[model samples]
Target: MSESGSSNWAIEATDLYRRYGTLEVLKGVSIRLQRGKMVAIVGKSGSGKSTLLHILGTLDTPDTGTVSVCDVPILNLSSTALSSLRSKHLGFVFQFHHLLPEFTALENIAMPSLITGKSKREAFNRANDILGYLQLSDRASHKPNQLSGGEQQRVAIGRALMNEPDIILADEPSGNLDTETSIQVHQLLRRITTEMGKSLIIVTHNNDLAALSDEIYEMKDGMLFRSEG
Candidate 1:
C-alpha cells in the first residue's frame, strides 16, 4: 500500500484515463469523495460514468492516473493486496440485484464475509443485522426470484453493507425500478450515507436523485465536471 493520505476523503482519483482498442473512454477524469457524503454522477449512457466508478471501486484499472481509497493509494498494490483492500473498504451495487437464484437473501448477504474467511456463525449474525437494518428481516429466507424488485435491491444493498465498507459505489442503482420504488431506494441510499456514515457514489440518470446528493458531477465526452448546485 502507498503511504496514507488525508482520512477525510473516502476516495481521491486524479487525471484518470482509459481506452479500449482505439476508443478513449476517459479523458483526464478526476474526483474526490469526502467521507459520509453522497455524490451523484449523472450523464447520458456511455458517458464513462460506470467506467469511473469501476476504477474507484478497484474493479478496473485506469490506463494512467492515481486512485486512493480511504487514504491508501491502490495503483501500485499487488493483486492479492488490491483484492483485500477492495473487499474491506469498498462495496458495490449495480442496476441489477445479481443475487444468486439458489441463495436466500440472508445467505447472499453473508457471502462476502464468508469469502473473506468469516465463520458462518459470524457472517450470518452480521447478515441478520444488516437485513434488520434494511427493514427486510422478514424476507431473509426469500430467494431473489421470490422478492419484489425493490426488496431484491434492498437485499443487494444489505449485501454491500455486510462487510461494513467505508464506501459504496452504486451504478444505476434505481434504474430498473418504477418511479415510486426508485424514489424509495434513492431515499434509502441517502439514509445509509447519513445514518451509517458510509460515503456513497452513485451513477444515475435520475435528476431527482441527483438533486438529493451532497454533490453532483456530469460526465460528458469522457470528461467530468462538477455540476452547479
Candidate 2:
C-alpha cells in the first residue's frame, strides 16, 4: 500500500504503539482516514486519544509503527525532513489557540507561510484571504489580548489554514469556548471540510461536534475502535 502511491487516504497508521518509559500509551492501534472527510475521536481524559492525535499529527514519534501522510512514510524521514513535510502538508489547532500575544491576528496567521520562506507580502496576502474566509477581516490588526476567546480561536483556525494544507489535526479546538461559541466553531469546521475539501481529524469530547463528523472513533485502554453507527 505504501508503494502504490495514492493520495486517497490523507492519513494511515498501521500497528501504532507508543511508550513513555514504563507507561505504554498506544497499543498496536491502526486507523485510516480518507481524504476530504472529517473524523472525530472521543474518549476519556487518559484514554490516549490525544496521544494518538499527536502521533498522527507527527508531533511525536511512535515506538513501533508506521504513519503515512499523502503517501509519504513519516517514520523514514529525518527530523528536519519531517518538520518540512508537516509544515507543507499538515495544519494543527489546539485547545489553547497558541497565538502570540504580541502579534496581530494577521501576523500570527502569516507566521507559518513566512517560516516556509514566503515573502512577508505574500504571507500576509494569504493570511488576509484566510481571515476573510473566517469572517475576521475587521479584526486582522487586533492583538490576541484584544480579541475574545472565540475570535482568538478563529484566528488560530485561520493560521492553520493559511498554508492550504491537505489535512488539519485539531485537539479540543473548541474546548475553551462557551456553548454558543462552541457551536459556531463547530459550524466553521464543518464548512471548511465541506467547502475547502480538506481532511480533518478532531479529538474532541463534545458529542455535538462528533455527531457532525462523517465518522467517529472511540479510544479506550490505549486502543482505538470505530463507534457503531
Candidate 3:
C-alpha cells in the first residue's frame, strides 16, 4: 500500500497518463479516494475528466500509471480477474440508467450479485435492502419504463450497490435529471457514502454537486487543480 493513502482508501491513482493516437489525454493525474468520503471532478467538455473517471473505474487503463483499488494493484490483472475484482470492489453509475427494458427494478438491481455467483435468494435480499434504503420499495416490481426518471436513476444506483462495492465511480449521474432531482440525488449520494462507508468519485459539470463534495478538483489542460470552494 502507498504510504500516502491509508488502508481504508478505496482508490489511489499515481501519475496516470493516457494517449490516443497523437492526442495525449491525461497528463500525470493522481488522486486518492478514502472510504466514506466524496470527491468530485469538474471540467469543460473534452477536458479529459471522463477519461480520468474511466481509468479510475478500471473500464479503461492508463498508458503510464498505477491504479489501486482496495490496495490491490490492478495493472497486471487478467481480464477475468479484473472483472471479478470490479464486481466485488467497485460500482459505477452513469448519466443513463442503462437498465434492461424488460426487467423489473428489483430484478435489475439484483443482476450484479447474481452475476457474481450469489444465489437468487441472496441477490434479491440484498437488492431489496438497497431499494428500501433508497425509498424505492414500492417501485420494486415496476419496469424501468414504468418508473420516473429519478426512480430509474435510483434503481441504477441500487444495482451499483448489489455486490456491496467499496467505491462508486459516477459520470454525470444527475446530469439528465431536473435541477430539483439533481440536488436530491446529490444529497442522496452523500448520505449513501456516509452510511455505507463507501467512497465516491464523480465526474460532473454541475457546480451544485461539486460544491457538496468533500474534495473538488477541476480538470483543465490535461491537469488537475484542487478547488477551494
Candidate 4:
C-alpha cells in the first residue's frame, strides 16, 4: 500500500531480506501488525531481531522486499521524506532511556515537537499532557539523573509519545529494569495499545513480557515466526 491507499494493518513487511556482506541477517522474514496491536519479538543476540526492528522503523533498509508503515511504502522514499514520515508517524525506545542528561524531563519530552518546528508552548503543552498519562507530571522538572530507573524509562516513553505517533518501536525497553519495574512497563505498554490505540513492536528477551503482547515472534537464524504456536 501507498499513501493514497488504505490498509487494515499498521505495519506490513513482505519477504524481507537483509545481509551484511556475506553474513545474511534476515532471511525473508515477513510480518503484519494490525492497528492498535502490540507485538513482541525475542531472540538471542545476533539473531537479527534488532535488524528487523530497524528496518521496520525505517532506520535501516532491507536488501529486498517492501515495508509499509501506516500504508505508506517507505522503501524508496527520499531521506528527507522518510525522516518526515518517521517524525510524524513513528516513535522509538531503546534499551537505554537516552534522555538528555542536562535537560528537565519536560524539555526532553518536548524535544521531538520542537525539532518539528512546533512552538515551545505547544510542545510543552503536549508534553505535559502525555506526562500526566504516564504518571510523570510531578517529575517534569527533574533531570534524567534525578529520576529513578523506572521513572526515567517512563519519561522516555512519555517523550516517545509527545509527537502522537501511530506506531511505537521499542527495542528492549525494559531490559535494565528490576522485575517489578519491568512488569509495570509491560503493563503500561499493553495499556497503551488498548487505551491509546497505538501499535507497538517491542524486542525483548523476557518470555513473560512477550506473553503480555497481542502477538509474539522469536527470531532464529534471521527468520521470524509466531511463538504462540
Candidate 4 TM-score, true structure as reference? 0.96
* Candidate 4: tens digits of C-alpha lDDT, residues 1-229: 1234567788999999999999999999999988889999999989998899999999999999899989889977999999999988899988999999999999999999998788999999989998899999899999999999999999888889888889999999999999999999989889988898899999998999899998999999879989882
The lDDT leader among the candidates is 1
**In angstroms, how far off is 135's CA in candidate 3?**
0.5
Q: Residue 207's C-alpha lDDT in candidate 2?
A: 80
lDDT of 2: 0.91
Give one digit per residue, the lDDT tens place, for model 2 in 1-229: 2125566899999999998888988999999989889999999998898889999999998999999988889987899999888987899999999999999999999999888788999899989999899999999899999999999999999999988898999999999999899889888998999998889999888887788899999998889989963
Supply the global lDDT for candidate 4.
0.91
Q: lDDT of all predictions, in order shown?
A: 0.92, 0.91, 0.89, 0.91
Off by over 4 Å in 1: 1-6
User: Per-residue lDDT for 98-212 in model 3, tens only?
Assistant: 9999999999999987776779998898899999999999999999999999899999999998888888898999989999998888888888888777889888899878898
Off by over 4 Å in 4: 1-5
Best-to-worst order by lDDT is 1, 4, 2, 3
> How many residue pairs in model 2 have overlapping backbones?
0
